[model samples]
Target chain A: MTEARDHVVPRRLIEKPAGGARLRNLGQYLFLAPALVFMLLTMVYPVLSNLRMSVYDVNVATFLSNSAPFVGLDNYVKVVSDPAFQNAFRLSVYFTIGSLVFQFTIGFALALLFNRSFPGNGLLRALMLLGWMLPTVVSASIFRWMFDGGNGIINFLFESLGLLDAPRHWLIEPNTALIGTIVANIWVGIPFNMILLLPGLQSIPDSLYEAASIDGATPWQSFRRVTLPLMRPVALSVLLLGFIYTFKVFDIVYVMTRGGPVNATTVLPIYVYQLAFNFFRFGDGAAAAVLLLLPLSIVAVGYLWLSQHEESSS
Target chain B: MNASRSNRRPGWGWTVLSTIIVIGYLFPVYWMAATSLKTNAAVYASPPQIVPWPPIFKAYVDAVINNPLALRSILNSAIVGTGTMLLTLVLASPAAYALARLNLRGATLFMLLLLITQLLPAIIIATPLFVLFSRIELVNSYPALILADTTFTLPFAVIVLRPFFLTVPTELEAAAKIDGCNQFSAFWRVILPLVQPGLITVAVFAFLMGWGEFLFAITLTTNETIQPATAALNKFIGQYGTQWNNLMALSTTVALPIIIVFASLQRYIVGGLTAGSVKQ
Candidate 1:
């Protein structure tokens, strides 16, 4: 409301010094100052430092030395050229796309199912939250066990039900491990997507559905016309949020496969960790991570845009 | 025949559909519990033990006491989680109040900036962060981790709590101001009493964000003493194979507090969660 009167971007609010309440603003800023300083120190500084690192080919072993060759465009060239880097890039795309596809499909289906009335719906909703609420590492650990070769319950069930001809190498095989991790992640992520879409469902008025019924529309047609169109914003938000969350998913892949069966599921976050911790190439790791951060930062930019739009409208 | 069957069924399709959905969600938790009980040998049994051939209490016991870090990690997680919750409210409440009630300079801009920070995935700068902490010579320190984890969580609390702060009518603050009170006095004595749900929401947001944190805890502190139970789960696997039963047992133990908090405070959470997602 005030922004229209002021007409400014990054618009400062009207600072009323004459009011008795102005003194409290001092205390408020004082309180918020530490968090602001902390963000600047830890988050802001490191981001700028990585941006600098991305432009230079600073070697790992001799990073502390001033004499380490600074080859401009070399790191980017090497990153784009190196087969391992390429493979990691390919695998990250594969993982992101595969996970997002399944996550969207299953999440939408689950949302549609749970959105309806049923016996024990409340208890079932609470139960569904279990897969989402437990820490990611725990989820990964359970998945790791389920994929175990010998006594693994997955293989036991599959073979017993004649789903597989033999005990499958669920994690050990390059073919199955990526799919397995995606499956595990799909299970974990469905609840979140459903949670978002559920409220979206609730917000859609029953009158609309009743109107569609009076028009002799089938349940499917009513849903197609009335529900899905209205749900676009929430669905869009869920999609964006899902991308942000899944793109940074490190725990499941780290724990279950550790960027393996021979680096099949080596998504960007896992690749970043491996380059730093396992390979001790901090600069290289930082560089790879910077490349990944660009897309994520774009999403953050979108979030900022939405927030501003919300403020002006509100 | 189709019309008769459909009429006779009477929403059984929806019933069966919901049952399948419920099963899909329940099966994983069941799997986790089932595996936690089975003997290592029986975990991979051919027929899969309906009940573990000989269920093990040993993993749970071992997880609680064996390396001793297990217990300490839990304590560390609790302290850090609580500390983050306190710090988030202490800092965020005032800012949220100022944004909601006090016409501070560029309150919306400040909020927009903070919201940007919340979406930032912490993984991007993990390497520099480790080195930065090392230069301060505080890499394995609790303060090192808490301060970092708070960065991840504080923006969320501030954004969620801000909307609640605004809902407190300007009239209340004005009344306090008119009654021989300074701005801070009015905020403290009168305004705060009204925003309890927002505060609870912030506290819960802070605690859970800190509780589930992993990247910085793993990267910044490699020590046994200061790490969280989150990173300790990584210790279960080594070069040879995983210690699965113990891992699940430890997970169950560590997750107890978070589950309890969610169960108790879920109502407050759902109210603010929408605002946080948009504003944050």
Candidate 2:
């Protein structure tokens, strides 16, 4: 019976040859065809077009027409040298770093707090996710109202608590405008960080903590030694993803301040939008976009390399 | 006995601390609903009322009756969102299956391409898309927004769904093939059913992507009638910034569906997001 079964298995496997392999290969490619087509049309083509348009001076008049004056890196020169672009670059760096630091710290705290089993923990954690789940525009609008000079609850609360001397225009003043947007962004970002980090925290074995405690180590000491080292990869991913997401933030900045109060909050994405749509300078807009893409591409490549290396090592 | 008592005391303290933090975090959302129920004068009152003494729904009434455009925009959002979800699922499912199941050459390259696409900011693509849509006269149209949203959703759906496909055992497909099913038939009849949960998760994500889409909505649509709720509400900011009550009411309206969807599908959404990252 065993010999008969082996013969049957070998015959079945040997039945298909090169033709069947080729046919299966064709079928696999066919399955991939639709998604590949859509990606090329929507992503690949548009990105290449942006690069092409950056070289040419395409404005409102020539935008519709096929022919535009070719300016060959002049737009790049113009964008890089532009004062607004430089300020926006500075602000982008500030905003990304600020949001990442606050979001990660607070999010990691929340993750640690919720790591243990407790009554109502699951429900509370789910409720906290509401901030991340809300529409960006809705959140922006709510924050806009909350930060309103006279009517905002923020001022009212601050004044009542003696935290502020007066009702400040949070979204309008140049100095406070960027800070206000960053505050709202941090609120939106914390839940994301927590959700990602919670799993990492949970995956750390309790035995390690008990082992540390048995050695007379305190809670903080265990966290420093056992938790932080184990959580490194997760935290790195969270920070990297947070940097990428926050660096390209447009909706909150656009809706909250519109990069206003003298362009204090004009990050890179907002700058690109203003140049392209508001000013009708498509070439410069595309050039600014290409500039933005360069750093992000580097980060993305790094992320890919790290993840691949991680998989191979594991 | 003393050690156990000490543990219980800290647990209560932690719970109280967590409640306070959550309340503080959700204050803005709570304030949104409260503001919608307040009179315009009361909203600007120096000492804001913790609870509206005499809560009113007048703002909601006004938003519903006076602002017909808001309703229309919501309808437009639904249409676009549904279209994006359907199209994204159709395209992403087969691709995910191929990537997860097939021994296709250059599959790694394709996965890398999808990851790179995520890093491409919307503003980068928005410029050329606007130009292209204008050339094709698709501006101010639902299809334009849907297609743009698909660009964001498709890559995400493929990435998330691919892992779920990988979890399905290969023997299941081989068994289906033994029963005289071809590759496509086996995928459709055997594998698709197994990954239904993943499909639903991706669909929910795709729909939310379309619903909450703001950048493309504001950029691609010139006509107010064609704009989604996000863009429509944004117009109110410029035109009626003083109407805080009405504006908050409209904001609540826009946020309600997302809240409902998230509350119901929190498990799937969280699972899908973490599964994509943690597995890799």
Which fraction of the native contacts appears in each prediction?
0.37, 0.62
Which digits, one per residue and each the tens of the lDDT, describe model 2 over residues B187-221? 78789999999998899899988999999999999
What is the DockQ (computed on Cα atoms) for candidate 2? 0.51
Candidates in order, TM-scores: namely 0.88, 0.95
Which runs of model 1 end up more than 4 angstroms from their true locations? A1-28, A56-71, A117-123, A302-314, B1-20, B52-55, B278-280
Clashing pairs in 2: none
Computed on alpha carbons, the lDDT of every model, listed in order, comes to: 0.73, 0.88
Candidate 2 deviant stretches above 4 angstroms: A1-19, B1-13
Cα error, candidate 2, residue B117 (Å):
1.3
Cα error of candidate 2 at position B144, Å: 0.7
* Chain B TM-score for the candidates in order: 0.87, 0.93
Question: What is the per-residue lDDT of model 2 for residues A1-314, given as tens digits with 9 covering 90 to 100?
Answer: 12233323332243334335775578679999999999999999999999999999999889999789999999999999999999999999999999999999999999988876667787888889889878899999999999999778888789989999989999999999999999999999999999899999888877677778888887788888888999998898888888888999999989999999899899999999999999999999999999998878778777767777877887
